[model samples]
Target: MYAGAMKDKRSDSRLVLEKVSHSYGAVPVLNDLNLVVDPGEVVVLVGPSGCGKTTILNLLSGYIEPVSGTVRREGIIRTVYQQDGLFPWLTVSENIAIGLRSVEDPARREKELLDLIALIRLEGFEHHYPHQLSGGMRQRVELARVLAGDSDILLMDEPFSALDYQGRLRMRWELVRLLEKRPHTVVFVTHDIEEAAQLADRVLVLSNRPATISRELHIEALRPRDLTDPAVIGAMKEILKELGLQV
Candidate 1:
């Protein structure tokens, strides 16, 4: 098994996966993978390279299906990707308005989209196309798109990886702020330890290839995490060790 060790849980979740496994012909990528995202909870998925972490997110977002397992989802899910994945031809307003098709009230839809842009702090750039925005701005627009959808859950795949140092910091803070307003369940995947530490309420650590949960870490630290705190460092090191890395 590519997965080193596994811990099985018996509890139920807002979303549940039972005996979940996936493969391609003779090769396998995930086996008996199990996890739960409680209603309105933020869960971050972390693992070493080639661990199939992104694959897990794709499955949950309905982009793909697990070969074997039962998936139970509460409501719609929206994704915010590292590349921002915005429509190149659409203006910011037009892109964020995609979800408005289901909403019948034109005034209400307009109001909500404007609120989303402001919440992500991308107010003045609403008319700009995706190509005209900066990296951070592009990400903000993508996040706004998700918010506009009023999704029940969010699947984020390394969305902040491409930002500059300060840009990532600001985006992290903004994310925390947005989550505070209307809490939604989230499954975020990232390779950065500190990023996980800062953002996730709970962290799921996975192993290589046929990935399964190797460990779960809860971040009890208050928002605006202290990067220099010894306690935080200890938790990070422990997770690195779980991934078979010497930290």
Candidate 2:
């Protein structure tokens, strides 16, 4: 669901960076990086570990500032992390409510919360604490919380990495379902080649260190993309080759 293109006539980008670079205690992590994400497109950053993937997510989410460039964002941003990023003490409903409470309009907030609860399929789990819920449920709560904020862009850092195979599979379908209604641009960072292929409209491959763009992939197939089809295999192979990983 490439939600929509960016609003800027200059580039159709909802978010952009100008020659962005970053460092860690004098050690360069990302150098001369520039990227643009359309308003509703999913851009996945795929690379080996320690290749500055998470750093890129951080820069976009405003958790960290760049050392040598700029991040331009068109709207409010929200993030969902691999760890679920939920307050264990809070019930699922509470977590979802916290973000909505800030919406300023009680009527709108109530309506939005109900819609998000239904979207995440967590209506009955509302009173359940994070520890009481399964991993997938916790992830849903995190997603719902992010949605409740009504952020224009969603940043996810391997939110499915910890899920079991079946859970991951279901989450992928659920994500497509959820996004269809929410329709927000997303920047997801993952090391999984197939995950990028399944979820992103565009996949940006990165170099080993001091990460830089290597290849940009466009998955033109329709969704529910067949996981084992030759078409998917061929595109995955091409991306792996571009990343210098033979498979």
How high is the CA lDDT of each candidate model?
Answer: 0.79, 0.82
What is candidate 1's lDDT per residue for 40-126, written digit by digit as tens? 677899998788988898888778898999777767678898895988999988988885657788889988888888887778888
* lDDT, residue 187, model 2: 94
TM-score of each: 0.90, 0.91
Say which candidate scores most in lDDT: 2
In candidate 2, how many clashes are counted? 0
lDDT of 2: 0.82
Q: Mind giving the per-residue lDDT tens digits that candidate 2 earns over 18-70?
A: 89999999789998999989877888899999999999999998899999999
For model 1, what is the C-alpha lDDT against the true structure? 0.79
